[model samples]
Target: MVSVAEDVAIVAFEQTPSHAHFNDSEPAMIMPCVNSVIEQVGMDRHDIDFTIAGSCDYLSGMPFAFVMNIDAVGAWPPVYESHVEMDGAWALFEGFVRLQSGDIDTVLVSGSGKCSPGSYREGFSLQTDPYVHAPIGLDPRTQAGFQAQALIAAGKATERDFAEVVARSHANAKDNPYAQLSGDLSVDELLAEPYVQQPLRRLDCPPTSDGAAAMIIARADKARELCDNPVWIRAIDHRIDSHHPTLRDLTDSPSVRIAADRVGLHDGPVDIAELTVTYSPEEIILRDALGLNGETSVNPSGGPLTGSPFMAVGLTRVIELARAIRNGDGGRGVAHASSGPALQQNLLCVLEGDG
Candidate 1:
C-alpha cells in the first residue's frame, strides 16, 4: 500500500439529486448538500477548518459565478476558503494534501454546476486547443466518438460492450435515490437504438445534468471522535496524459493506469469501484486499465452514465465509494474520476472500512 504521512478519513458526505434543470440558483442547489454534510457530522459551520469549492464560471454563464456560490457554504465569521476552476474532486485532492501537512484537522470540499443555462457542447469545446480543435468546433461528444471508434479499431471493445455498460448502469441506478435515470434495460435493446454520434448511441452519452455534492474529511484523531464509522482514505493520486488527442492512444487510458499504480489500487482486494464512465466506452477502457475484473462490482451506484453533474460528478464518485464502504457493502474500494477530452486526466482514490 502507498504510505501516507497522516491518517485522513471522510466523516460525512451529501449530494443533490441529479437534475436536468434545478430550477434554482447555483447557491440554492448547493446549500442543502452543504448543510446536510455538516449536520451529518454534527459540526457547526465554523467548526470546519477549511472550505474549498470547485466550479466553472463559463458553465454558469457568468464571470465571478463561483463567488456567489460561497453563500451556500456560509461566509459569515470569515472562514478560510478556496476555490478550484476544475471539479470538486480536485478540491478534495487539495484538502487531502493540506490535511497531510498536519496543520488542519478538518476540511469541507464541494462542487456544483448548472448546465441548463448554457450549451455544454459549445462551452466544453472551448476547453480544447483554440488554434486547432476549438475553431473547428470539435466538441466532447465528437471527441468521445473518436475514442469509441479507436477502441473498436484496436479490438479492445465492441459496440455491444458499450450497450452492456449502459444497460448495467441503468439497472444499477434503480437502487440509487440520487440517480436521475434508472431502470432495467437489455443490452440487445440498447444496441438497436440510433446513434447520437457515430457508434455512440444516445444512451451511450451521459445526460446533461445540474447537481452538487459535499464531503467533510478530517485527520485520524478528529475523525474518530466525529463519526463512529469513518471511511479511511488509503491513498490518492492523479495523472494526466497528452492533451492533444492525436498524440495519445485512445483505446486505453494510460493516465488511469499511472494513478491506479501510484494509489496502490491492487495492493489489496477491491470490492467495488466507482468509475467515472461519462461515456459508455469509457467503462471498457477504464476496466482494463485499472485491472478490475467481474469479481469487482463496478459502478454500483450507476456512476456518471445515469447521473452526471459535470463539475461535481468526479467528486460524486468518491462519495459513492465512501458510502459503500461505510455501509459494509465492501471492505475496500477504489474511485476514479477523469477530466479533459477523451479521459486525458485521471484521479484515483483508495478507501477502506474500519474492519
Candidate 2:
C-alpha cells in the first residue's frame, strides 16, 4: 500500500431514510444505523480510529441528549471522541480536521437529529442572540423571509424562481428514500402554494426531519487498501459568520464565496455540487456565490429541502458527493454545507477521482 502522504478518501457512508414518525427513542435511531455503517464499510468498532457526532439537544427537549445516544456507538473503554450540537456537516469538518495527523487512520463520523419534538421555528429562535434578538422571538425562517424580499428587489430571483427549486428538490427526493418530502408537484403548482412566512412560501422551507448519516475516512493508502474505488479529497475548509444577521449583508453569502474559492470551486465548472441549502431562497445565494451556472449539476440528491434532519443534513451532503466520486460518476465534485441564520456559515470540500 502507498504511504499516508497521499490524500484522504472516504471508505463508506450511510444515512437513515427520512420519515414522518421516527417516534423511536433517539438512541434507537442511532443504533441500527451505527451498526449498519460499520458493517457496510467492513470494519469492526475496535478498528475505528476515532469518533465524532453532531446533534441538537433541543430536538429531543433535553440537555446533552447526545449522552445517552453514545450507547449507539458502543464507544466504551474511552475511544477518542467528540460531539457538536451544530449540523453534522460541520461535525464532519471537525473529523476531517482531526485526521490531519497521520496517526489517525479510519474514523467513525456520524450526526443525528429528531425534529418532530419542538416547534422548529421556536427551537431555531434560540440560535439568535439571547440578550437582544431572542427576546423578539425572531426565527431563522424569518430571516429567509426577508432574504426572499431582497432577491425580489434586486431582480436576482423571484418567488416563481424559488418555487422551481422546491419543485425540483421534491421531484428528486422522490428517488431518494432518505428524503422526507418526495411527491409530484409542478413548478407552476408550487408557485400557487401559500406562504409560511411571507415572501417565503411553505414549499420554500425545509421540512423538520430526523436523520443520521455516517462516513468512513482513511488516509489515502489505507483507503486504497480498503476499497477498490476511492474518492480522494483534494481540498476542504469551512467558515462562520457573525451571529448578527442584521449586522451582515443578508443578501450575499461572503462565507460561501470565500469557502468555495478556498476549494477552487470557481476555478472550473463543477460537474456535481451537493449544496446544503436548507431553504429554497438560500439556494440562489449558494449558486451565485459559487459562480455555478445551470449547466453544472446541483443537488441531484434532493438537498436539505428534500430531507433536512437538522444537524446531520450537512454531513450527508459530503457523504452523497463522495459516493458519486467513488461510483465513478465524475472526475471531481464539490459538497457544500451551511449553518447559522440565512446561510451565515459555509464549508466546502472538493473531491476528485483517481482518473
Candidate 3:
C-alpha cells in the first residue's frame, strides 16, 4: 500500500446529468460542476492550491483541446494546473499524490467529454494495437463480445448472468437523477431484445454520454475545516495488464486483484462498491477479481452501464461512493475505475467515514 504522508479526504463533489447529446462545448458542461464543488465548501477559485483535469483530445477531434476547458476554472488569474489524457480518476490519483508533498492544502479535479459529435466506438478503437488489433477493425463492443463468450466457455458465467446484471443496474439507476438511463427492467424483457453482438445484447453496452464531474479534496486538517463529514481516502492503488488481448485470461482481472491487495480491500467488511462496469460481463469479472460477496452493494448509483461519460465516468464512481458514505449508507466502501479496452488498466480506491 502507498504510505500516507498526510491523510487526504474528499470534501465535496458534483456531476452533471449524463446527456445523450450536450450540444455544448466541454467547458460549458464542466462549469456547473466546478462551480458547485467549490461552492459546496464555500471556496473561491483562487483558494484552491492546485488544479488538474482529465480528458481526451482525440475525442474532441482536436489536439490540445483540453486547454480550452480552462475557461471553466478561470485562467485569467493564472492558476497552477495540469492535465491527464486519461479519466478523471487518474487526475484524482495525481491530486492525491500532490497532497502527500505537504505543500498544497487543496486541489480541484475535473473531467468532461462530449462523445455525441463523433463516433465513440471508432474513436475508442484507436486505443488498440496499431500493428495488430487496429488493422482488423476490432472495437470495444467486439472485444466485450469476446469476453462474454470466454465467460460462457469457461463456465464462469452465462448469458442470463449478463442480463441479470443489466436488469439490476437499470433498476438501481432509477434513483439516480444524473443517470441518463434508468427503469425497472427485467432480465426476460432485456433478453427478448435482439443482440447487437452475439451473447452481448445492446443493453449490455454503456450509452455514449456527454457530462462532467468535479471534486474538492484536501489534507486532513483542511478537510475538517471544509466539510462537517469528510470521506477519508484510506488507500488507493492501480495496475495494468498486458495491452494485447490474447495475453489476458478475459474471464479474470489479475490487475484488479493486485490493486485490491495493495489497497487492503479485505481488511474489513465492505458496505458498498462502485465499479466501472462499462460492459455487463465486466461486472462479473470485477466481482470475481475483487473477491466481493453478496453483502457488498455493487454499483448502487447504477454505474457506467446507465450513463457513461467517457472522461468523467471513472471519477464519478469515487464521487458516488463518497456520497453514499457521507449519507451514512456505509462506513467503508470501494470505488473502481478502468481505462483501455477489456479492462487493460484498473484503479481501486478505499474510503471511510469519520464515524
TM-score of 3: 0.98
List model 2 lDDT by residue over 93-144, tens digit each.
7777777876788878788888877788888888889999899988889988
Model 3 error, position 296 (Å): 0.2
Candidate 1, residues 1-355, lDDT tens digits: the string is 4679999999999999999889989999999999999999999899899999999998999999999999999989789999999889999999999999999899999999988888988998999999988999889989999999999999888999999999999999999999999998988889889999999999899998999999999999999999999999999999999879999999988889888899988889999999999999999999999999878999999999998999999999999999999889999999988888789889999999988
**Model 1 bad stretches (over 4 Å):** none
Candidate 3: residue 246 lDDT (0-100): 89
Q: Give each model's whole-structure lDDT.
A: 0.93, 0.81, 0.93
TM-score of each: 0.98, 0.95, 0.98
CA deviation > 4 Å runs, candidate 2: 1-6, 267-269
TM-score, model 1 to reference: 0.98
lDDT of 1: 0.93
